[model samples]
Each structure stands twice: as C-alpha cells, then as structure tokens.
Target: MWFHGPDKMINVHKMDRTCMALSFLSFDRKQDRRKQSAGAAGRKRFSVDFPFEAFTRDIWIICVSNVVGAFGEGLYFWVFPLYVMSLQADYIQLAIVTSALMGFAALVPIPGGLLADRLDRKKIIILSWTPWIFAPLIYSFAQDWTQLIPGTVCWGVSMLGLPAITAYVISSVGDEKKVTSVLSFVWASYSFSYIFAPAVGTYLATIIGMRSVLQISA
Candidate 1:
C-alpha cells in the first residue's frame, strides 16, 4: 500500500525550493563580495560617517512595516484555510489554492524587483496594501470557491510589493555593512508574531467564527 500526507508533501516541496533559492543567493553574494574586494584594494581612502538621523528613520519605517505586515500574514495563514473549509472546499482544493498562491508569489519577486528599480517605492507599498484592504471584504461575501478566486489573485499580486519593500529598506540604510543587522531585527519581529498569532487566531475562530477572524485579518 502507498501512504501520502498532502501537507507533508507540500512542506517538503517548499523546503526544497527555499534551499535552492538560498544556495543561489549565497553564490551571488560571494560574487558581489569578490567585486567589492577588488574595488576596495584599488582604493586608498576609508572614511566612516554615521548618519544617525537617516539611520533612525530607516530603522523605524522598516520595523513598523515589517511588524504590521507580519501580523497580517500570520493572521491570514491561520484563517484562510478555515475560511476555505467553511466554503465547502476539500483538502485537495485547499492545496491547489495554496499552491497557486505560493507559485505566483515566488515568481512575482523578479518582476517586482525590476519595477521597484524603476518606480516610486512608497507608491508601491500603498498599491500593495490597496488590494489587501478590499480582498478581505470580498472574501467575507464569498459563498463559494469561484467567488474566492478573484480575491486570491488580488492577494497574490499584492505580494509583488514585498521585493519593493525590501529594496526600499536596503536603500534607506545606506551602510551595507549594517544591512544584515537591520534586516535581522526586522525579521525577528516578524518571526515573533508568527509564534503567537496562530494560537490567538485559533481561539478567536472558535469564539467568533472564521469569517470574523478573516475580517479582522483583512
């Protein structure tokens, strides 16, 4: 007999993709470092200037946006499957929807990065949040999976702003040396929210139901 767990399979696939992306990113970083080292070896001046005001603003914005976005994402993860199940979707349908969303998300960042280089970063952030504000209300009214597809597509497209947001943070910090520290702080906050939001969302779902949780998340 054959045994398969759908959730486990999906998780394994995601892990594989993440590892591959990480490996490529690491290689790219190494190439960048080699080029930087060659440039530095040819230079004779080393000046350290700390722009405290600019650094403060950059850190504040990155921290605030990351925390808020992580909370929204965490709440969505907790409630979306429950919402779909409420609409009479089976496990296979749920998996299909999730896979589509993830597929679009992973593919969109490249275009997003290119567009971010050419466009106003702040506008991109606002535009990303625009669909999210409306998608949940649409989800609230959805009586079937067909009605859910539009909102799902909107949600998927909104993820294009993620790369833009990341680029903006890196640009704002200015000092490449501190970029990792700044990003780590922001990511730590985001990770912390994921640790707590699920339990709270689950309790809320039990008390007020999934639709209400979706509304709150939206």
Candidate 2:
C-alpha cells in the first residue's frame, strides 16, 4: 500500500507537469503569433502611409532626372534678371525678353499635346530636354541682351516636354489611386533642387563669374 500510494502521487505529479508544459508551449505560441501579427500590421500601416509602392522603377528614374534638371536650371534662373541687367538690358528690353520667354512657353502646349499623343513619350521628353543644354551655353556666350533672345527661345522650347512628362508619368503607374501621390512626389522632388541650388549658385558665382556658372550649369 505504501509503494502504491507513492506511485500514484508520482504519476499525478507527472501529469500535472505535463499539463503545465503544454500550457506554457501554447502560451508561447500565442505570444509568437501576436508578435507576428503586430509586426505585419506595422508593415502594412507603413506601406499605406508612405507611398513607397507608388515609386515604380520608371517613376524613380524620372524623379532622379527631374532633380538633376531642376538643379541645373535653378543654378542660373533665379539670378537671370541680374544677369540681364549686367548685359546692359534696360527695363523695357528685359520685359520684352521675359514676355518672349513666357509667350513661347505658353504657345508650345497646343502642339506639345498633339506631339505627346502621336510620338513616343520618352522620345518626346528626350528631344525637348535637348534644348536646355544648349540654352545656357548660348546665355554664357551672349555679348549683349539682344543676343540672349535665342537662349530665351531655347529655354521656352524645352517646355515642349511638359505634356509628355505628365502623360508618361500617368501611364507609368499601375494603380490609378496612387497617381496623385506619385505626381506630387515627383513635383516635390523637383522643387527640392531650388531649395539649395540658388545658394550654391550664388556661392559659386562669387568664386567664378556668372557666365562661368551658366557654362557649368550647361
């Protein structure tokens, strides 16, 4: 009887230990599941809020190119009036030049839209951007304000790509809902260059001449 009593007690203890171990394992699994769910929720929230998925490969490439182009243009565009005055342009001549720049840019959109619809958008963008490279070079070599007319025209010509860029960006995204965010992101990226390029340009112009800066920007 004494041996049987101890054996029952030991068996009961073993059963209790087994139950406790099972409970612990179950609790651990639940904890792991909870952690995994929480992590997944965090990742999902991040993806929804950050617009990361909207930046597809083509969009990213365009954003990078926009930054570079904006920076290059900003380097001299802000100080363009001063550069004009330095070239002995009177207020009237400056106004004429500015008007010509704006007028041509405004007019190009009509044909630009047609071209964007008919031509390969990528090629349109490339062709339009080509004028900008030469525009600043023209500006750098100008002897007088009259000579800047061609440069201003070239700058205006570069606006021909604007429609193509917008159309290309819209077409590049698979998700329609992400279009606004993606476009805003791209525009914001371009604006980033203006924040710093003017300061850098001013500093460089102090070290080098404005013409040299324009040449460098070109």
Candidate 3:
C-alpha cells in the first residue's frame, strides 16, 4: 500500500538479510580454506626434518671450538688493559693499542666472509687458532711499542676466523632456523667465561705477573 501527500511506506523481507549473511559466511570460509592450502604448500616446500646426528655432532664441535676461542678472547680482552698499565703507557698509547686491535678485528670479517664461501670453514678455524700459539709468546717479551704493536696485530688477525666458524656451524646444521638458538647458547657460555676471566687474570698477575698472564692467555 502507498500513502499519499508527503510520505510513502515499503516493507522489506527478513529472508533477504539472512541470505546476505549466509553468503558472506560462505565467502569467508572459502578464503580461509585457500589460506590453509597455501600455508601447507609453503611448509612442504621449505620445512626441513631435524637431522639429529648431524645436529648433535656439529653442535659438539662448534661448542668445543667456540670455547677455545672464547678462552683466548676473554683473556686477551681482560688482560690487555692491565698489560698496558704495567708498561706505564699513557691513555693515548692505550687508546692506540685498543684501536689497532679492534679496528683490524672489525675489518677482517669482510674478507673472512669471502673466504668462507670458498674455503673449508673448519680448516679456517684451526688455522686461526694457530696464531694464538705465538702471539702470546711474543707479547710476553714486549717491553716497548715495537713488540706490542705486532703482537696486537697478530691477535686481531687471529679473530678473523670467527665468521668462518659461524659459517661452518650453519652449513653443518643444514637448517637456518636453528642457528639463532645455537649461537645464543655459545654466546651465553662466552659471556660467562668473560666474567670470570678478569678475576683469574688479576690473581695471576699478582702472583706471577703480566707476562705469565699473557702466556696463560695464549
């Protein structure tokens, strides 16, 4: 029925609204299904099974290698300041020594990355440790800048192996996802060792002196 003058009335059926709601729900369900299918396909394409043997063996080797490196790093970092102080070096000289060692260490990672792509990473790591065998011995005899400079440079070069060791672990594990967890564990251990190393160095320096501390570090 239509009303005259200024207004008109119309009736709408409730069934139409119900139909619209149902259609929307149906569309949503289809979208969800498509998403699920895509996710499953993606997972199938990239998911890697945990290689238990490889994981265990590689983790052990990485741990041992990192521990050895960490031991040297902690001692080197902790004792250097003391060593410089023993020489009665002024702040400027100390800064120079620190800069030389750290700057070279920072620069090494770039070339090390290139080498890592082409070289056997494990061999690189072993070769890196070889420098430690002599660096400390040389530092023990360092009475002036001449001896100190070369020893510090060698220490910096030795650190170049770090990235290679990391690359080896990642490659050996064969799963990129686990790299963070593994590295976290290694770094936690490294931090713990660093905390205690200074105390040990201080005690040793008091007893046997700075040269002995450098020898022990090496």
Cα RMSD, each candidate: 23.7, 5.6, 7.9
Ranking by TM-score: 2, 3, 1
Instruction: Kindly report which residue stretches of model 3 are placed more than 4 angstroms away from their true locations once superposed.
Output: 1-54
- Per-residue lDDT tens digits of candidate 1, residues 34-100? 9999888655232222233335675677667667766766766766877788788999988877777
Task: List the global CA lDDT of all models.
Answer: 0.74, 0.89, 0.72
User: TM-score per candidate, in order?
Assistant: 0.69, 0.78, 0.69
Question: Once model 1 is optimally superposed onto the true structure by TM-score, how far is the C-alpha of residue 176 displaced, in angstroms?
Answer: 2.3
Best by lDDT: 2
Please provide, for model 3 over 35-112, each residue's C-alpha lDDT reduced to its tens digit, 9 standing for 90 to 100: 999999877555433233345575676677666656665665676776776676888888888888889889977887
Tens digits of per-residue lDDT for model 2, 35-119: 9999999998776656777777877877898899889889988999899899999999999888988898899877888999999
Model 1 misplaced regions, further than 4 Å = 1-54
**Residue 200 lDDT (model 3):** 73
The 10-residue segment with the lowest total lDDT in model 2:
1-10
TM-score of 2: 0.78
Kindly report which residue stretches of model 2 are placed more than 4 angstroms away from their true locations once superposed: 1-46
